[model samples]
Target chain A: MPGINTSSLPDIIFMLLFFFMVSTTMREVTVRVKQRMPEATEVQKLEKKSLVSFIYIGEPKNTKLFGTKSRIQLNDVFASVDDIPEFIAKEREARDEADRKFITTSLKVDGNTKMGIVTDVKQELRKSGAFKINYSTRKKVERRSR
Target chain B: MARRAAPEINAGSTADIAFLLLIFFLVTTTMDVDTGITRKLPPPVENPDEDVDVKERNVLKILVNSHDMLMVDGKRSDVRLLKDKTKDFMALHPDNPDYPEITTKFIEELGKEFPASKGVISLKNDRGTSYEMYIKVQNELARAFNEMKDERSVELFGVKYSQLVDENKIKAINKLVPVRISEAEPEDIGGK
Candidate 1:
């Protein structure tokens, strides 16, 4: 009796592996800040990944780098509110000319972070003309029906 | 004969290699993209007037104290009940003469005063207030306007407001009850 052909199985599996590898965008920046994202209802997905830039705000995971205070992260480097405009301009230039108009700023702030930093970031964003912003949140069923 | 045994490669391990990679991906693959509450930051004003005193009844006050306690118009309130309360105030307050019905219809058809637009949602949070509570309050206000618009859209066009693609219909739908949450300057941490 002939055994089932196993030669093609590897090819199929490899395709799946490559599919995930290509589609999955691993978290580019390791979140140094401890995050407990606030939950909400009106959540909308980012339309295009290419046009979006993320800003991370929270207390540092390693106290040596950020101490106990909330720190902002732009890309891989820890940033400050003053650095936001420069970072946004740099982020805008890195995108395609056609897509530049749609660039969005994503604020991934920690729950424990004070609103002071957040408001400052918003001011910086408004000043920089990076008008579109997303307050990153999670979704869960609401407590009441009404 | 030597020809009886053809030169052949061992293919049995191919499945193992593939399985190993497949499992690797299965374990490592994460849904990394996150969805959130998207909003537009108003362009910075050239010279903003801080002294403009908005009418008390026209402004719906929402404050998050330093202790993370939520207060709607000085009454201790839960975040869960915030949306309903906001809809009542913003969409149409029963007491507001301009909004005889909790309907934006007058604003849309008659071009008359809109209670929603007149009724500003003033949000002031303490510097010591946790970002979590602040975001929760914002979320509730956002939900209020979205739900109100959707309800009006259903009433007018028989479709969800957000689902409408026609520019005219959208303008007509949200003309009055636009999502307007004014972030007042943060209260100093010293004030508590």
Candidate 2:
């Protein structure tokens, strides 16, 4: 039997490797809370990922340690409602002075969570002067007419 | 001694190296694009106790309880009917005194006078209400305004509001059918 050349196999694999490398975005934080977002029909795509700060609200993954109550997460740590202003301030300071106005605070709250926690977070955000807010939600694909 | 070509190094392991890196990236790749409902928060009021008077007839009250029950204008209603109800309430109905009052203003972009509805949707939910119900209500309210805008856009520009690309045309359409949903602070109306 004649041997078929396998030299091009490396080139093809290298091409795929480069494609994956270019497309991949590393997960920024260790999500310590369960985050099943709510679904909505009128969702807008969040532009400029770098300019968006995320606030997660859900039951903690380690329920035994953190208790069953929902908690707020800023970056990788469990945070309280009071920590929100400081977090927003830190996020603004990290960016360029001109880009501060464009920063959007994205709230990723679990659907099962109560509105009280989310409202508290919103009020804190408002007080911090971060008026631009995005309620992170999944897109509802099937549209049902009434 | 005759010059000799260097022996070719074996490239057999190159594929394995590439495969390793590709696997790493594939595992790390999160293809999920972040999407959400964008909203602008009303600036924090210095005097929160102060009240702004809006005509009682001009505001549509929607209340959601902890059990996810909806109340529109003090009448229990289904979520499915919210869009149409809002549309009817906001549509220009000069003969109907129960509906919002219409004010005529000349739009610079359209170069004509248009009667704009002064209707505002006031949504209040209990603190114990689920986030899912809140989003559903928000979605319905947005749909109501969007459908009205689409209708007006079709009438004037022969296109859907979302399909219109011209900035001036969009401005005119927005002026004709503005979205005015005001969410109030959640109260402990429904005991958890």
Candidate 3:
């Protein structure tokens, strides 16, 4: 029996590689907090990723250093509520003048976290003039009733 | 002289190179789409003490205690019943003084006057309330508003609200059934 040709294997591999590269996005910030986002039925896909800045809220992975309290994360570092305005300003400055108005702050708060910290973050965001915000949540699938 | 055929380039290592790059991308990237409940925060008030004089009947107050118990319009209610309750509250019940008063306004996009509910959902939660419960309450309120919009869209355009792609039609629907959920500052209710 003649050996089967395997010349198309490289092309197939390259196709898969290209698909992954196009569909996936690079993880921008290293998440120091343990974030388990809450589930919700009413969710809209965040459009224009460039215009979205993320704020992570959850207990730190290293409990020894950061304590048990929920900490706010802006970019790669753990930040307090006071740092949010500066973070917003920095984010705004990074973008073009036209795109500055379109910036949205996405809050990825852990489900188990208390509302007090979240509210504080929200108040800080309000003072900073970041009116548009999104609560990052996983899509909850509902079971059909008979 | 007969032209010699060019040698075929070796392609066996291409698969290895592709595999290496694919692994790199797989390690560095994430496939999950960022989805969430979008909201607009009201601008910071100049005078925090000054209260807006909204009529008593127009506001539907929803409170979530630290224990995750729900209180809707001063009545203890289940989370499952919230959507239906909100829908009923916002419905055009002109004769019912308990329900929100309706104001008919001329919508430019629709080119017809429609009754818009003056109802506003006020959500207040305790400082110790879990984020999960807050999101659940928010989801229910959003669902109620979405259903109202869908109902109106079907009656006017013969299609579901999500199915309507026209910008003006969407704007008209939004104007007809506005999502007026006002979240209040977290209080230290029900103790820490």
Candidate 4:
């Protein structure tokens, strides 16, 4: 005669589920922008980030404003220096809930863009009260012209 | 034996579900990677380093005023002109031909011309200027410096871009070229 002994199975399952939920991390939202990253052969990788923010460099179409270049998106777009701290703060709050440390940001500046704009973003981030910032860069891909 | 054995509540199915959920989350979790130019910032000063005489010549001072005015080396200049002048300042062997990265060129040129001058870029921005422009300046400066370093290795040292490019070497050189970005106080820039 077979018997069903059922007490440890539930406990084991609950433990496993709880472990996964705590260990799991959500994917960060990234914005599309071209960046000329500094050439560093040996770059140290950073693991923890409180917030990840992206700044896109380029002019908005038909906008006289300094930072606004395109007419499409606002959330993805950061028009001026004043907008940085707010974005960083919001990201900080999100990260804080998860017990994260510092806010991290990536500024993607176009090759044709002016250097002043890059400096502006850096300065803003520094003042935005978030000390840590990451500028994104792509590995140089060798393209063979067909 | 017939009166024993309370009803068995099998919780095995729930346990299996929990285990599966845990595995799923572990597989789906994403990681964050941080990247950028690393520079050792000067420690904060209580009284501030007032005696530090920051030279205007060797140190490229990029000033963006409230009205979007760009100033290089204390003189107000257009962005295009600034780029050209910066290139000229960095270009060491004008007659040798083949322009290199502007920042690297500038450093090499400075090293040759002003041997005692420490090659550094000090960025100062007016309080009222928009933030977007500030980042642009920093990026351009870093780009310019990086370009100069790359060009110097190629043109001066005969190291082509295709050569065994050691990234550590580039980073080493970049580390020496420190950047000090300073912002004018509210009273200094007439900002509220």
Best candidate according to TM-score:
3
> Can you write out model 4's per-residue Cα lDDT over B42-77, one digit (the tens) per residue?
333446446566444445667777766898777888
TM-score for each model: 0.82, 0.93, 0.95, 0.44
* TM-score of the first chain alone, every candidate: 0.90, 0.92, 0.93, 0.53
Rank candidates by TM-score, best first.
Answer: 3, 2, 1, 4
Itemize residue pairs with steric clashes in candidate 1. none
**Of the pair 1 and 3, which is ahead by TM-score?**
3
DockQ per model, Cα: 0.66, 0.81, 0.80, 0.18
Alpha carbon lDDT of residue A51, candidate 4?
Answer: 51
Q: Give stretches of model 3 more than 4 Å off.
A: B1-8, B186-191
Task: Score candidate 2 by lDDT.
Answer: 0.91
- What TM-score does candidate 2 reach? 0.93
User: What tens digits encode model 1's per-residue C-alpha lDDT throughout A29-132?
Assistant: 77788777988778888878888999999999999866999999888889889999999999999999898879989899998898888988998999999999
Q: List the residue pairs that clash in candidate 3.
A: none
| Model 3, residue B107: C-alpha shift (Å) | 1.0
> Which lDDT tens digits does candidate 3 get at residues A29-110?
9999988999999999999999999999999999999898999999999988999999999999999999999999999999
Give lDDT tens digits, candidate 2, residues B1-192.
Answer: 998999999999999999999999999999888999888898887887898899999999999988999999999999999999999999899968899988997899978998888899999988888998999998888888889999999999999999999999999988888778888865667577
Cα lDDT tens digits, model 4, A22-120, are 766665434434334433332334445435555666445335443444211115554566676687677667665655444456555544454455555
